[model samples]
Target: MKRLIHFAACLACFTVFLLGPTIASAGVSKKAQSDFEKNLLGKDVKALLDMPAYKDGLDLYVDHKVDKRLDERGIDLKDLSKYLKDKGVGVERDEWVTITDAKIDSDRIEIHLGGGGEGHGASKNAAKKGAGYKRAGGSRINFRYGRDLTDADVQADTFLPLLGRVLDTSKIIGVVIPKDVAPQFQEAIRSRDVVVGMSYQMVLISFGEPDQKKVDDSTDDSLHETWYYLKDGHRWVVKFVNGKVGKVQVF
Candidate 1:
């Protein structure tokens, strides 16, 4: 009887020892930690101050050692420390533009663009010459029309894709017109102000040539010339049949 009681006590003690951390961790409030981690995951903070949650979390984790919650999520303290030094998210800030004034909407995050201008001189000259300029002001011109970025733009990471949810085309552009706009923008061949051909040229005129183009030879000849657009966080495939638009899907 004594031996059985001793073995039972030892087993109970061992079980408690093993389950102590798990129970304690499970009971810890993950609300704040979750919100903080959600904002930090897949994000880098080089300048820290740009993102309030990152800045605060970094401070708490490094200085106050208040990172037990995050530690449970497989995040390394050293990685956070390096992120602080880098002053950017994911990679170096020099490689990617830091997004600021990020307004989190239901589907997309509207990031405020800052920094120098591009194509403004040409736009101004065209406007001065009465060539009809639609939007000409700052570097933010690229974001004005909601056009996807080109290969060059991708290298620069100028337009970051929004995750979590897909944005409605009408909501993104704030316009409700026929789907012909895609073709008209690409081919520069407008159709009676109704439907555009939505060819490669039209896409270039609107969103510019894709950074990367792929052709699927696996498909039959009737469904060839399928072009893919990759920019920021968005990917789109435009299918053409017999040199005409068949379907366009963006993700």
Candidate 2:
């Protein structure tokens, strides 16, 4: 009987996993979607890289909300590029981007993405120092690495296919930034006097504006809004009760 019960439990778990999507699709909750969208709006990508829960939430949002939204709009690769450009994000054409350096932080990983350009223009000088491949673009793309980076650590790696998808679909050149920049950026965020009811402009003055903001009215009384720091994928939740900052949570 015990063995039978264990088998039954495993079957139930598998059944739930199989039915999860059908149940979700049958009655997709607009409130949940709205809440998620609210949180992602103007959030910095860096903040998300720092928190496991928020990162998982982002994955869920991408799978359920972003994918569906794109589908509903009939958006294709070209369309996504246009959308990103319209939002004032830079997009490059036919350029090669690579990860230059990678390092681990307490809650995140710092990566630097750069190409040969500007001051470091197209020279094997950086690569000679073991900074990875040299590109022709004369510019480098820097990325702050989070803890979730995959084992392969290659640009074409399969662990995070969505990242590759975004890079391929968009016109912008994608590269990882220098690993050293992480400490400096972290110091900057820590020093900033983040406050509640602060306008986006004000936040930018301190920590720069987030890449996106996920807004929701139904958030707990403690949290007024959630912001994502794009550069590092770290996040901040501004909490309030009576229109004042009651607390702050960083993920």
Candidate 3:
């Protein structure tokens, strides 16, 4: 009986010796785990990446591939890009987009934004209602560790500073300020205001792609480029001389 007890103790020690390294390296760091649980999971985070979602959503992915594309899941996403090609704009860059859901596996964290992509039901519902279908876009960022993840990898990712690199840089079209813009360019963009002296680029930055554009070639030196915005019975005509706002007409 004493021998049996001694043998059991020896076997236990042997097991520990074999599994000690694995047990130590089984998971991530204490701080990473703590941050993920306390600051991440079920919490909203501003990834601060150049992910410009469509009015619907933008598809983004990280190095960690959590799953196949939603299109493979029977979503008719083939025409999504083609159909939304001409759509004016989606989410404004530099805004807090979303972190609707996240899936954390032993090796990676799969994060989803804007409901993780469009659903078939949503498209059908819009079609049923006799309205054009507008499914909000989403991104799936998979924080991957090619090898076993350590604390450092998770702490310094591209998207979440607390996590690892965000390997998604698709369709990032922000307001273009070709040159030095007005002092109130940001304010004007916020207020949707366009005044004289705002450069053509500033106006483009303030507003998105205009509805119409007409150029005046009558002058020899400086050509006047007229941009018009028409929406919901509101009309704005902005004339730019030498790329600077010369006149603004509202109707």
User: lDDT per residue, candidate 1, 1-251, as tens digits?
Assistant: 99999999999999999998676444213453344234423342222112111221222111122345434222344655543333322222112233333332222223322321223233334334331222222111112222222222222123223111111111222233346454434223221011225555455544556666656574554646666776323577777666655777767
lDDT of each: 0.35, 0.36, 0.52
Better of 1 and 2 by TM-score: 1
Error of 3 at 191 (Å): 16
Query: Using TM-score as the measure, which candidate wins?
Result: 3
Candidate scoring better on lDDT of 1 and 2: 2
Candidate closest to the true structure, highest lDDT: 3
Q: Which stretches of candidate 1 lie over 4 Å from their true place?
A: 1-196, 215-223
Q: For residues 16-106, what per-residue lDDT tens digits would candidate 2 score against the true structure?
A: 9999866644432345334433422222222111111100111112232345554311223344333222222221333333433333233
Candidate 3 lDDT by residue in tens digits, 13-112:
9999999979767777666766654444444333333332232333333332344543321222343344233331222223344556655566666566
